[model samples]
Target: MTRPHTLLLAATLLSLAACNDAAPSTADAGSLAATITDAAAATDVVTPADAALAPDDVPAPERFSYVPMGCTHRVSAPVGSTSNFRDDRSTFGAAPDPHDVHVNWPADPSSTIAFLWRTDPGTRATVVQYGLSPTALDQTAVGSVGTAGLMGNQVTAHEVHVCGLRPDTTYHYRVGGEGHWSAVQRFKTGPAPGRTDYDVRFVVAGDSRDDVSRWRQLQERAMGGMNPPDFEIFTGDAVLVGFLQGQWQSWFEGARSAMSTVPFVMVHGNHEGLSVNYLMQFAQPQSGVSSQDELYFSLDYGPVHLVVLNDTPLRSDYEGDVLGTQLAWLRADLARARANRARVPFIIATHHKPAFASSSHSDEIDTQAVRRGWAPVYDEFGVDLVLNGHEHDFELSKEVDGQGREVSGRRGTRYVVTGGAGASLTTLGAGALQPWGAHFESAHHIVEVHATMTRLELTPRRLDGTVIEAGRISLTPRAP
Candidate 1:
């Protein structure tokens, strides 16, 4: 007589076989189930070859399946959550118009992605259909909808969170509901945690306010080549005024091509301020802090640990110690990342104002405050790189410690101010290049970063493909 566990395994196999054209014999099912059991107990190690297989070539058991690693799927509150709303704008027989559709990672970049789009305030459907193939979007995920008070007008913003995706895989998806849908768009997920076999690529850009033409050109160049970046890191100042709906619309229209296919990791800039408009537009991972959830957070992609902070000073009317609370959170977050440095070797921090820059804004009050408060924290945690914007120029600093002393041999934090996406260029300030400044230039450019287990390379290039400067950081092992 067969055992109960064996019978259960056989039943599961038969159910799976139903999806295929043919089912195996009873004896064959028993043999296959025993083989699967032995394989499961053998080992869980994934080899380099396994990581290199194309999405279509992955083994059947693992294809389109979720790898459980204790991830919590959380969706952000819909628009109008913080502001007063008008009447519902939905009509009885109107076609859905999904515009400004974009994607971002609100959870683990490897296993989850958040999609946001806008429609008339009256539209109500909030759904996303996705799958590995464009023709076959068999899986569906429901989301929430809310209204946003854009200037004096109201628009409905739809946000959907899709989780349990395979790492380094390309997926096609569409958003809508009630039998109306948008065109299909494709995006690739980031590499899995502790996986060093794949190279991670991304673009760093910022300060594109008031220059829609230039912004479009920069994005076209960044996403034109055969090998585009996995995602983009926008250093903020995306619009001239954060609360103005027109500016936000223009900014998204300029980034439509790049944002449609790759996730954007955003840094809140001074221009955006603390407005409900900014909060309602983008969905980001919560920082677990009540007041500052999407305002500042951290995420891991490939072997790099990225921390985004809100270094801008609080509004005069707001209460509580925003900066102090963020500092405490930073210390704890960096400690956790440092403890796991053996797996993710690089710690990169990004904010709006620069801790080290030799440009027009270098001597401003906010920039100085950011330098005084945050530079030491970065040094204490052995952060490898710091990225910033708001200078409207390009500047890269030598390795510097918390005390404003230059430390050579890659032992200190290196800062780069890459705020040349579209805003008018500004020249370096008089006597701004200090001992720690390695390079400075006033040009429209973007920084392209390529990261592997043992090496990280950053190349800043102008719109015309001219190389502004290049730098590399070698991975150093740390003790647990």
Candidate 2:
């Protein structure tokens, strides 16, 4: 009647890949797999909510619903083969990460939310028709930037940001299209500025490629399980450059159950760089801290300040990646945090590559660009924590003060790299093992971060839905 709780262990992963033995069958998983596989073969309708493999950007319109003559711009897409599950549509034509929908608004409780998404070139101007109640779709909102579309292989992305939304209010919206509007979606703005006591959640994961089943497991645990996260942070490299579209699509549609219910805060990963297609397709937080040039920005959630940055270009910046432009912005932001430290005590960041990897990648400097650029700021300001994905393993580094010295009593920034979400694994205990090596698992996993004013909790899911690693870090105000 009930399925075995999947174990987030290495053995479960081996089964998914048919690596060693048949994936250990749970009591109900086999039947569930068959049903899902059957659904995959039937080319009916799939939407963003069901989590089936489909378009990456928009959740499929309600399944089985037909579009009008010009509802959708028919671009070339290979029909999937006759299989229940696969990480790659290698048999199909090149699969690319589907264009995405990016939504955000300031924590100024009364700020109108901004909803942005990309569409096929065939569509004209983008607008979101939304309202608190789904039945009364009466509220019509517009974007400041008139119709903006960027071209890729066959389609173009449309970006628009709407404002003047009430803080912490939920509104349902549909993107522009001739047919039935995109599956009705909804999002709520952050609590008003200076208001910090509220509940929020954002799932964090990175380096998800190839082992889509592992990723699926993560979605199951995060969204399908008892509790779904509030939003999500895609730390980066959700897929590879070449031969990555299928992987990207899998990660997207597969996670629809979660994304449809929650918002995605996407951060550029190194793998995101190689995938020119990624840039062309997904619309992101592109203003203020991000403005037009860089994909770096700062946002506020209840009692937290969240920063997202690009790792690839930090080195090429005219002055310094973390020191110059980003540094200036970070300082201004931190200064604000300093004054309002009472309201927002936690400062966190999400970047793709990790500065400290204790696997086959431990000593490589290429991955430490963020550490090189922004370590000082983290040290100077007493940032609470940083999340990264790259290494094919999960690790919670030792607790250390900004200067890299291991701290004992309190007041330290913790660096955690949850790269095991789906990337290949490597041997550990060989390099860069910090005294802070609290937990390490040489397996596949998804990173789960939960925090409150007192402390932060991190748990990495092994493929079978079991926790492979866990760590707790305490947070406190800086000693003046």
How many clashing residue pairs appear in each of the predictions shown?
A: 2, 18
lDDT of 1 by residue, 1-480 (tens): 122223323333332221121233465345445544543432332211122222555442221112213347544442224222222233312547788899988888998888888876666677788999999999877666665432242345777777789988999999876456788999999888888788888999998977888888889888998889999999988875454566788899999879889899888776664444566678788776534658788999987899998865333211233347788888999999999888888899999889788776676666676787789999999898899988887888888998668987666888989888888888867756867788888888888988877777788888788887444334453334
lDDT of each: 0.71, 0.53
Local error of candidate 2 at residue 148 (angstroms): 11
User: Candidate 1: TM-score?
Assistant: 0.80
Model 1, global lDDT = 0.71
Residue lDDT tens for model 2, 98-158: 2445454322323534454444333434456777877777866433211111111222343
Worst 10 residues of 2 by lDDT: 73-82
Per lDDT, the best of the predicted structures is 1
Residue pairs with backbone overlap in model 1: 89-122, 90-122
Give TM-scores for every candidate, taking all chains together and pairing residue i with residue i: 0.80, 0.70
